[model samples]
Target chain A: MTTRTTPCAGSEAAETEVILDLDDISLSFGGVQALESISFDIRRHEIRAIIGPNGAGKSSMLNVINGFYHPQKGTITYEGVVVKAMKPYHAATRGIARTFQNIALFKGMSTLDNIMTGRVNHMHAGLLAQALYIGKNRREEIRNREFVETIIDFLEIQAIRNTPVGRLPYGLQKRVELGRALAAEPKLLLLDEPMAGMNLEEKQDMSRFMLDINEQYGTTIALIEHDMAVVMELSSRIVVLDYGRKLADGKPDEIRHNKDVIEAYLGVAN
Target chain B: MFYREAGDFKTTYKADQAIFPIALDRWFVVTVVLVFLVVVPLLASNYMLESILTPVLILSIAAIGLNILTGYAGQLSLGTGGFMATGAYMAYKISTAFPGLNIVFVLIAAGLCAALVGIAFGVPSLRIKGFYLAVTTLAAQFFLLWLFTRVPWFVNNSISGVPTAPPRKVFGFLVSSADSDPIDRYLFVFIITVVLALVAKNLARSRIGRMWMAIRDMDIAAEIIGIRPLTSKLTAFAISSFYCGIAGALWSFAYINTVEPTAFDINRSFEILFMVIIGGLGSILGSFLGAAFIFLFPILLNVMPGWFGLEISVTLVTQVELMVFGGMMIFFLIVEPHGLARLWSIGKEKLRLWPFPH
Candidate 1:
């Protein structure tokens, strides 16, 4: 059934559902054609997975959506506002956050401190506030600490809160990276290969976390993963990119049965 | 274990952010400061006071400045002595030209001039980093030093090209080079150095200091975090050169008395850098430690003759002092890679728990 209905009076749709529309985005990196006419639409509260093999431009596609790499052609409209060529920080400040393929936590700082740093843009306290550290500044600092503590509790990293991020295990590091991203309180969370190098148990835990983030917080998640089974289980809609092109876009079952997807995954099923 | 913060509590933020939060560490610093100010002056001979304490303190201020730019901001520089020369020569030209002007005013004017020079050199930091930046600063050092020597106006057409710091009264008391009593000069340098050190310490904990440290740690991350690197680095250079200029003014007015174009030599720049390295990168206390070590060595070298009951020429002793200084620098680099500041921190870490250490 079509979910579309007549526009209701005295109600704002933006206040309810968010739209992430990437329209005919074409991008090239030097001699390599990284993405060609790639288009995808992500709705609020839905889990969207972009699954593909290595060198399939999956990461590049995500980077484009988040404004890390400005596309040579095309437009990305988030919440009805078209995003032009802008730096990564611009996206960060505008309620969009992402975690890297390799965990990019500030290694020298504590896990709690690393997460707290993610709130740098959001924090109203400036340099003067930092220096004098007066009434409101102290209050803000306490507030920041409290906010970080909640994330630490959510991730169950209370025991290692004071520990440096560099010394933590890889799975824990990935969790910390996720914590940092979540610290930004982004409306759209982009996870690039979140389960890239995780063990089965870790991957399951991450999937649960992702689901919790979606169901509990109502955050829209766009992920890139190699695990087909996990992708089928988690995503309502799957985006398959092959050689800088969208090979398949449909429901989990539809993608699973698609002959083109089968050919792309198993090389003609030989 | 003894060296744990298991029970020692910091109820206040100020306490937590102290230069040394531990009670024992605090006392140790107090004790050291007391020894330097009160005990040393009484015990040490006039010649020792004149020759060592004053010079080391002056150099310590300069090192702290360089540490701000190079150590904290990650903008490597080799033109420290040139900036120092800028201060010294400018002070000389001004003080000699306008004998009626307060010595303090001349020193400040000289510092301002050196700050301008520092900013000029700092412009290159925007274009380069690491070794390339260091080489560019080295060019500044060579050029500035050359200017002082080649330009006749700098020395006021004096045959010797080294201006003499005339007998000058500060608040009705004559503090002058004509006295030749190094004690009075040492006292003047001591008061100024302490004031400068306190100011530097305050500045370090300021907004600019955090910005510099952020840039130093990771520049790209810093930019994204909203810190402008150019603004932070240039400010660091200006403040650092200002200190170097002051030190240079003190070098001529208090210690050297009559300076030459070669007075603010390249070796002096290396000496200041070594002070930071041996003391600790990004540590004010380290600069003082470094200066004290360098300052004490030459005097100890002078005293070796009386202790050993041997006759070594003063020139040979000075040469040997340089060799020993060079050797000690290498030894410190190998022994404590993080410098004396790290050693101090480690010692404090152990002492934090004291008798209960595992």
Candidate 2:
């Protein structure tokens, strides 16, 4: 129901300048390699989807981008600056916000509080002012609350604004997680399986919100999704990973027709 | 009927974010404060003022301190007594060194000393958590108590290793020492407790409070959300110790009127922890409730047997009090893990939905 032009109309524009570039990245845990020689680039203001089967390093790629995990090898470049290492909070302060593959909302906190936490970077009230809660702290809190309320309205989660995220249904939890990330007003939003456990109707609603977020805010999104149909419809470009290696990188139509991608990821018996 | 809020509406965010949202709750608090200021001293006996009321008010401040660290920030600490001792000694030194300084400033300076010590011990919390972090705080408690005992500088090399607190005046009114009325000391501690509690309540509802809660609820998620665990956790330590330090200063200067290394021992730390656990971890009111219950229970236990004309031995009464205290701790842990604060909230929740029963 969100008023927006088709998502693809702007995907073909020549103004697509690269915002993130990962070159020859590798990661391993103990002796097992999680990713090897993976390379990809995400352009500005586009919905980029990463797809793979289970344990194919899709989540790890998202982790590396946000500085949750350090790759043993490879360099990550964002907006022409090379990041030698990533600390999670550092990346968040730099306007890169992300949702986890699992719903990682603070279960003990209410939805409003959870979303309010996303404004931590922007809030600068010191300890003494906060302890008094008289002027700056109070004003900052109200202002952030207003901003978070907009996110709650955007995601259509007004009814459950006070509910503890732990009690919400899986689909609603995912939506709240998205709201939390969007509260950061990020330049690049990373979503790990945003619709992983959603029903068809829930998936449709989530897809619409994602499109609205991208259209209204002009936010650059990179999401990992397993649903081929949802990926094909929502993403401007798709990158396929199989067994810790990149199998294909192209538009959804090209990735759909690529034999190696279909065989490695979709398990097509060709 | 009186608790109903059907017609009440907040016209602004400032009103909505008030410490007490309900009009009735606000009125109730106003009434309590008025009564404490105007009526309490007139009716309370010297024994009640000295033994029960002063200790409750002071320890409640300490419990609030622990709640900020262990409750709000989810950092378990057992160093409350150590920090309290730091405050007591620092206050003693500051008062003796500069006789002209106000006792209030002395207490504040002592609290700062305790905060620095708390931060020093809290550094280990960054690398460890849960039971291990607790052990580190326990180490701080033992180490501080040992330091006060072994080092004569803290006690000013007194021959007895115990010093009677010298008389102190605040605003030209005698508030501490044998000559001061119990009511004077009670009022003095009462005002300080009230002020510090208000500050704690404000802090618990502010952005800093939310950040601590985020770290407590989930540290990894909190980090990704742009909260620095190092800073938030350490601040929780610092603030918690600051409160405990003030409580410690009051313990020696206003309540006990004496300074001794054994005054703040490991037992004191455990006692404060019990108050936090039994009161409610995260609730400011819970800290006061827990302190009152812990402080008054033994006296109640002692008086109950006598009231029934049973003529029970003092030893038997003490044993029964221990049994009852342990039993209540376990019961609270099992039945209401959130402590008495959760129960209070549940009662309020019922009042909010009284006419339309769920």
Candidate 3:
């Protein structure tokens, strides 16, 4: 496991308390290490980016934080409580929501239905209430519908509201995916390759939405992305990973000129 | 222009999310219900009620049950027949055990019993999925069938291995018994189907339905999005079985009027599946359409040969019917895999855009 002693120099500048604290995180699939001794803190209401080339374990780190993968050695402290053996659904209930690298909207369902699913945790109506859809459940549904509609309107997806996500184009699907994640009203939102395979216009749109979400909702974001320009422009702090290890942890300006990061991006000699 | 929603406006989310959102659609449903309740019993012949309309109503209820699981929830279940049998036998036993219980309560109790059994079988689904989960549910079908057939206790130790539905009363009207009026039985089952169907439409439009669709769409994503697959999947199975159980209770008491293990066989499972598929996998209307197609199509074939002044052998007619049914299923599947419901929706869409290019 690679260990780095980077002082908490940036946290003092941001004035935001840590929302997620990963301590001595190490994960390996068989003998191949995915992440090694990585430690970082995502602060409250900050857009944080984990950027690296292929096989740098960016996606792996997001998976660990979301409780999709349990590291061999690590402690994830979420909201000041050390989440012990936390399940994915439990993480979701704790308000940790994420969008996938591949758009994962329910293909057979309308965009409205897909986004409404994000409110599943917020919804408390039981089976009989839902089955009957009367009084309490109906009111709950309409309330949630209003909430989801806000997301839809915010995302400007009214035209495709009734269309199946499967029938949507890739860019619109990505937008809808964000809408779904946003509908959760998550405290911490993770975006895995949110701008992957997008044209220039779509990427700009997504970057704008990401910025607006962070500013408007005060959502703490931890996004894994390959787009360096978007990462540099959008995120307040950047964590750079290389060969399953954290190379640098600082602001975007510090990351851009760090000697180690430069060498990591431009392959180091043996 | 007739189907346009130009003048009608939804003032609130509740009005917008109504089962029939448009005024015309709402009126259409009201008209259909009125015709079914008032006109069908008065105009239809006894033979049509007994051989065609009655079975369509009952089986559509069962198909709706299966559609909730296979279509909406994306859980492929082959244990539908077993669940129905559970309802049938439980209703029979309960009705006999308590002689004075209302028939309505007995049916509800039967559905609850089947729900318990459904939850038990659905436990394996948390681990298994897709066709493998389907195979596991198949075990439920066979196991429950074996239990019902072998256990004479379910049949009340009857010599015939058949558990007959005891006579019962609904709204002070004698139905679910031999010599009961066909129209009375039809009305009872029809009311139940209509009510349940409306309930299903409502459920499908609610948060619970969205969770099922999420799980069906992508379970891993669903879990990440906070849907507990265990609860969602099991709830789907339980509710689906409950609907099937009621349909079974109604089938035995109202339609079939005789209970045998063979009645809820694997063929019945396939038939229900066919109904959901042909009717439209995730649609209430599709369930009725598919059931009508399956039941009434055969009757049509039986009468068509005579209408054409051709005398065909009964066996040959049956053969042709099977071939024609298989061919039609393939045709529908190939033409529009979404089933008759999609076709109906497409027509509605066209109507909405009629007299205009776009």
Candidate 4:
């Protein structure tokens, strides 16, 4: 067990409020417990990292947050609202967006369209308006396209905007996925290994973009990353999980020295 | 070189988002439309207009509809034939009940009626998916045909259970009924199909289209991105059925003159599905191409043996046509699952980069 340390007094992180909190969430599939009694908090305008070994329920936690899986016993408080049961659509509409561990992009569609889909909640034109491509529908489409274009520009993926995402390289696909999550302009962006398959250059680029996203848009990010150095560099606070149980939750430096976390990563001596 | 877009710069998102972004492509479309609307009508024979062109155009509309549902939205529906029956019956009922109504309004009303039925059938998609959902829609196909056949009200209490569309005129030009000219019917069907196809294209490129594709590509991800499965699936169903409905109405009223419930049976459903598949699942142009190929291929098969100076029996030609059709379908599916539209686009892509191997 590692002692949880509070944010240092008079710091910007301490001044921010908690945007999302999970109260003892437990998830299971049949008899196998994927996540058990896990609790964490993500503060506004901060990058919170959840780091653990393989099958430590990191992706499961993201799935629960996005309402893809329902925990048998838990309460989720997002932006001051306590939700008993959240649907994925409801979470998305309430400003929660996420990228998958494996790329879950619309492969048949172009990169621009894939990102534009993130603006689905913002578009409200009726079928008739859409069919005719007049007035409100046309205007709404152009507006969303412009917003998506800005994201493409920001992600430096303008060259592949018209290319189908399935044909894109792995690193670019990950970037497009992040761009899609960003297109929603989410309050809390959940990234599941945003730099999982990237090379050193791509990983550096992704880290910089994540930092810029945190600084520029002030988006509260909760990411599950395995690279200890990048995780330590990017996150303000870290949550260590071992076998679905929280081992430590504190600043990155504290987590690096936590006995339980070290054992969970390298194993205990015989 | 003509297909190049090098100098054509789009300054606005609106320009970039235009259906044909390239100036030359826009002009090519305009030229094709002009030739079809003006030149073909003036030069085409009665047999060409009635037997080949009009039916192809009408079926193209249905293909576009199915493409929207199954191709774009990734909802497998075997209810197209039934929805078409609903449209045919509804058009018959509306035009007869309200003789003073415009022919256009009658077709539109029939489509709306089918849309309502489509929404009802689309409910199962939320709970079930893939082949299971397809089975539910297959039930809709049988039930709708059964409803139209068993209920006398659909056929206006006619003993034969077949309804003939009363002669109707658009802009004082007779376009429906047995006595109407083939050119008028072809032009009418052509105009309606062009409009509907354009609308389908627009919907495909817009937010709704993207929503459908997202759901098709990944429903769980789409849901997390704020798309409600119920709304997206149902909308695809409603719109797809609407196009099929109008196609059905045109099939009975404008082309066939009178249609029985048997006209839109399970075979017709399969036929339309084939058109969507062969045309391209998620492409408006693929729907048109598939429709053209399916409708015209048999006629071509029958004539080709004669043109080659071979004296072939009618029965032999028919048998060979069937085998060839089946073989071609398999060949296309295996060779290019995306259908003719993808091939067409690939050809265009190659043309754009001609004289250089990229």
Candidate 5:
């Protein structure tokens, strides 16, 4: 039962509806088992964190969620629908969006343009309109621009909106990357090490932004973070991954005390 | 006073969505197009029109086609000449075999034929990227040229391996052919180039265009966003090849009056690439600038000899041209990597913000 595990903030009645279901998910590249028969359910609107040392398959889990790498075996059920292997764009259109551990914003484009690209799905003005810059196409463009402007403002990137992301500070680039994901209005937001390289101030700002996004937009968040403190502070439920296997899945407090989780953290494999 | 978007009011999405959202920018383009189409014909001599304008117009079209694949789509191609040749040869075959077919219809068909080939070659892009991908496109260039030269039917078994364009007329007036005036030829090419350029611009701003840029920017992210890489890439190839085909057809029918397989040689491919490179990579206007720069610079270089009445050797001119071209490429890459388009945009921005760069 999820009662003893998968810590959540909402009422018991609403928490049981699954957002993501991993059934005996097994994946490998050549001889290495990147993930092995991992099974779990991510309930709707929960801030879930998958944590482990380097090479614990945290990123692999994120990749598998969006069908970047088809697993060697197992089925992934998202929103009560089973997905054998769906394209990334299909996952995106289905309201799933993710950020990379390494920043992946369009390097040559200004931050505003980079995020605006996320709204391409919503803009339907055909090539003629875009080229001719006539009538309905122009209107759609402005509307998209205004929407992106609001997102830029919301992300507090107004000062650097016109600056190419390649020139931005590392923290700002990460925020812009987050802004890009937010532009898609995803129902499930995946963050890979959102606070990997930030100092205290950046960590605080990003943490606040993550919490605000969850509270205001009611977006579901799943993240992988190496910083135990960040995991402890932000995650309601912590899924511990060790050598591609699930060592523990429980409330943050329970995970802190579990011996198997302790052994994994202490670098003593069991 | 300088680069401001102040008073660019927008009541509807369309008002704000224009490619040139600022009224001033739109007016500038209209004014330039007017000068190029209406005014130039009235003032320019036949010699300038034929020798200068004709080639520039044709190169502009070729540059735009390759820009779609290389610039906007983020795929580098070295096989533009091959696709263009496909168009030329196809046009030749269609014109000769299907005698009495309007040349206009023949031209469109030729471009479509080239587009099919472009899509075939573009498929390899799904697997490779950057320099490696560029080399693969060469296979398309060489293979296509070989097919045309060795295949007797392509040239209608002509001994020259070059097909001669029959003097074609429109309503009893020769628009462009061996006997047509360069002025008449320039006008026809200019008109068609403008229309196709508009289409290219439209395409770059559409969903397909955005998909290409997304693929260029980040393939992993683009795939995740529900865009099929194959579709985007192939579309870019299709569009690019169509333009190249049109340009190729124009080269034979209007400008050259004859084209051998070597006409669409590897040098032709590099020339088109240089046009894109010197022109801003993703900027449509860059194509014109690049074409003008590549085409006009040689003439300007040759000017020194002409003014002094010095009969400079073609070898000397060719050598000097290479040096200047190489230097220009390196200078542009180091100074402004975005190409000529960025330079013009920066100039416009400066003009917009002039005297008030606060």
Candidate 6:
């Protein structure tokens, strides 16, 4: 894979610092190659969309980025540190947070509690202090809770704050999942099909949330999305993958006109 | 109407995050504590204190411990009796060795000892879950009991393998010896149980509690979002065992005044598990409710035949008790899997919407 760090022509490259760089990352499950020699860089404060058809290894790419799946080959550089392999805890502590392809909210916990779990790394009180629920523990809880309330406001899930996520509808659960990921105050957010199974109205709401998250928080996002229209509208840049291989990489319009991407993913017109 | 939360506005997160956020709940808890402290001691007979309330409180602690692991952390364990034995034996050793140590310090030290053992047993939980982890803990149960029973050192070289509680005093009042006043023992166990239950409630609402629940709900997602499964699972085991240990210590020192390894056998573990399940898995109140029901129901069964003027034999009563307990377990599992605590909460919810139907 060639170095493709230069932003496509006609796009702003002022914030050119690469927050995460996947260098020749290859992963497989026995005989099947899930992601082969995929090199990509997620820039700071950019909505980097990973677009692919079925079996294109989009989720696999996100999994590798978040340290859920360690590649058999290559290194992942995050914040300029070349990490050969990362534990999910290490990835999360280093400001990498993600939402899953299927909504993975804690089903037994209240929405507020689910979001509060995102701040586990930030909590430092000892067992005794927490057991007593006084002084430092109480103070830390209130402080983190205040921060979480802001995310609750952003996601507009205040009505269901105390409702268990399992009881919520799909769109609301997805929103709660987003709220949970956002609560981590991540430097890079990996979203796997953030709008999957949502109606058009929910899709628009999620798209607005993605744009607002990118613009307001200045968080770098790498998303695996199947909705072409949503991807075109939300992503600053797009990477096309086909059969565990990179097909094309460029701005949304550039990928839209890429012949190979059209033939492989969009399909050819008669 | 009595359970209504109307006009109870919280202006701060601290108030909002309170264990009893509702003003009515706070008042209700305060009233219950007052009754236990001031009224129950003054009114209850020696038999009532020793056989019923005291055992309920002690077993409630063990139930809470099991609840933290199975109910909240989602790690099924059958090591409650074994961990309790560890605590009971540890307390015996600590008090006997120290001779002049306060009972509070002894209890805490015993609980710590049990927590360490719990952590060791908890290590297997990292690789195994559900019934498999339960089976591993079942091994802990048998091994711990066998170690205590076979090793004369645990009973301090007693021929009968029974360790007796030496006389211990708290605030100049005898609390541990068999000759101690029943009221003093009841109060001692009651105070400790109340404080420990509050602590358990606090832990359940804190970040650690959230971590346990996260692991319980979906461990993969929990790890991805950065909850260390090892620490969470171990802490659950440690805290649970600590509670069980304290309960065991009190059982030997205060409630029974003498304990054999048989006191904390497989039957005891199953009893506590029953309490946790029937009370509520993830609720602190459920632990107490479960303990009360399991302990009192047997006594009630024994006396119930007399009240009805029936000529039921003792063996028949025992058989009926076993059958009824089994039937109730199935009934609760199917009707209200969350246990009696969930039922209590549902009642409160209904109270909030009284005089109206939605």
What TM-score, computed on C-alpha atoms, does each candidate reach? 0.80, 0.97, 0.96, 0.97, 0.90, 0.97
**lDDT (Cα, tens digit) per residue for candidate 2, span B1-358:** 4367778898876787888888998999889988987799999989989888998999999999999999999999989999999999889888888888888888899999999999999999999999999999999999998988889888888888877777888877788777888888899899999899989999887878888999998888889988999999999999999999999999998888888777799899999999999999888999999999999988888899777789988888889999997897888799989899989988888877777776
The alpha-carbon lDDT assigned to residue A108 of candidate 5 equals 69
Return the TM-scores of chain A for each candidate in numbered order. Answer: 0.92, 0.96, 0.93, 0.94, 0.93, 0.94
lDDT of 4 by residue, B1-358 (tens): 5368889999999899899999988999899999999999999999999989999999999999999999999999899999999999999999999998999999999999999999999999999999999999999999999999898988889988786889999999999999999999999999999999899999999889999999999898888999999899999999999999999999999999996887799999999999999999999999999999998988899999878899999999999999999999999999999999999988888888787876
Candidate order, DockQ descending: 6, 4, 2, 3, 5, 1
What is the lDDT of every predicted structure here?
0.78, 0.89, 0.88, 0.91, 0.85, 0.91
Candidate number with greatest DockQ? 6
- The residue-by-residue lDDT of candidate 1 on B1-358, one tens digit each, is 4455566687764565554667666776689777877787778898688777778888988998898887777788888999999998888888888999988788889898899999988998877889999899888889999999889899888787666877665666555575756666776777778777766765565445655765676665554444556777898888889989988988888887775757777887777888888888888888888788776777787787889799888888888888987787788799998888889878867776677745
RMSD of each: 5.8, 1.5, 4.2, 3.5, 4.0, 3.5
Which of candidates 1 and 2 reaches a greater TM-score?
2
Worst 10 residues of 1 chain B by lDDT: B220-229
Superior by lDDT: candidate 1 or candidate 5: 5
In CAPRI terms, where does candidate 4 land? high
Rank all candidate structures by their TM-score, best first, as comma-separated numbers: 2, 6, 4, 3, 5, 1
lDDT by residue (tens digit), candidate 4, A84-121: 67899998988999999989999999999999999998
Candidate 3: misplaced stretches above 4 Å? Answer: A1-13, A268-270, B355-358
TM-score of chain B of each: 0.90, 0.97, 0.97, 0.98, 0.95, 0.98
Q: What are the per-residue Cα lDDT tens digits for candidate 5 across B151-193?
A: 9989888987876887776566576567897667877888889
Error of 1 at A28 (Å): 3.0
Candidate 2: which stretches are off by over 4 Å? A7-10, A13-15, A268-270, B355-358
Q: Give the alpha carbon lDDT tens digit for every residue of A36-147 in model 1.
A: 9988888777788898878999889878877668899888998899989866667777777888787766665678766766676655655444545555545665676677
* Candidate 3 residue pairs in clash (backbone atoms < 3 Å): B279-B286
List the lowest-lDDT window of 10 residues for candidate 4 chain B.
Answer: B1-10
Question: fnat, candidate 6?
Answer: 0.89
Candidate 2 has an interface RMSD (Å) of: 1.0
